[model samples]
Target: YAKTSRTELLHFTVGGKDAGWMDKRAFTATLDKATYSKMSRGAKIGDAAVSSKHGLYTKPNNTAEDGEKIGLGSLYANQNVQIIQSAKLSTGVT
Candidate 1:
């Protein structure tokens, strides 16, 4: 395990790709105060949270039309779905 400090960013990978970094706040939020304290004292955080039990879901082989019918609330909504990052649809950069 890599040495991780409270202020340092925690890097994580999914499917052998760089998913992103978990800042101190986000990383702490995942655990209780005791667990965070233990980690702060040098205990390692396991990769169990990255498993299927977490929010990660498998994409279904379905068309967009079918996805709409199933409702966006469903876990199998769409494979290419992404969280909206901003109010603007496009910045006209292209």
Candidate 2:
């Protein structure tokens, strides 16, 4: 399996009527054959703590950009504000 840091905006309908939107992370979207096999055998996958269960994804290190802000922390603050940047626009993860 390949690893990537990407997110996608998904729009879909359930039961052909209900519509919804979500931010889908690429890393946990699908499972590879080998990892599936291991899971089928009752083996834990992905990152694990010493006293806890393992995660599903083989390499779940996915991250999303929440944008960068360069301004006053409080809205009431009387300070010069700088420009604020938004997160990158993404169609899908490669």
lDDT of each structure? 0.35, 0.34
Stretches of candidate 1 above 4 Å error? 1-6, 28-94
- TM-score, each model? 0.20, 0.21
Per residue, candidate 1 scores C-alpha lDDT tens digits across 1-94 of 2346546566888899988777644543331111111112222222443322334212221211122232233243323343422121122221
List residue ranges in candidate 2 displaced over 4 A: 1-7, 26-28, 31-94
Alpha carbon deviation, residue 59, candidate 2 (Å): 16
For candidate 1, the TM-score is 0.20
How much lDDT does candidate 1 score? Answer: 0.35
Instruction: State the lDDT of candidate 2 residue by residue for 1-94, as single tens digits.
Output: 2223665666667789757666655224433222111212222222223312322221322322332333322332333434232222233322
RMSD of each: 20.6, 20.9
Q: Backbone clashes in each candidate structure, one number apiece?
A: 0, 0
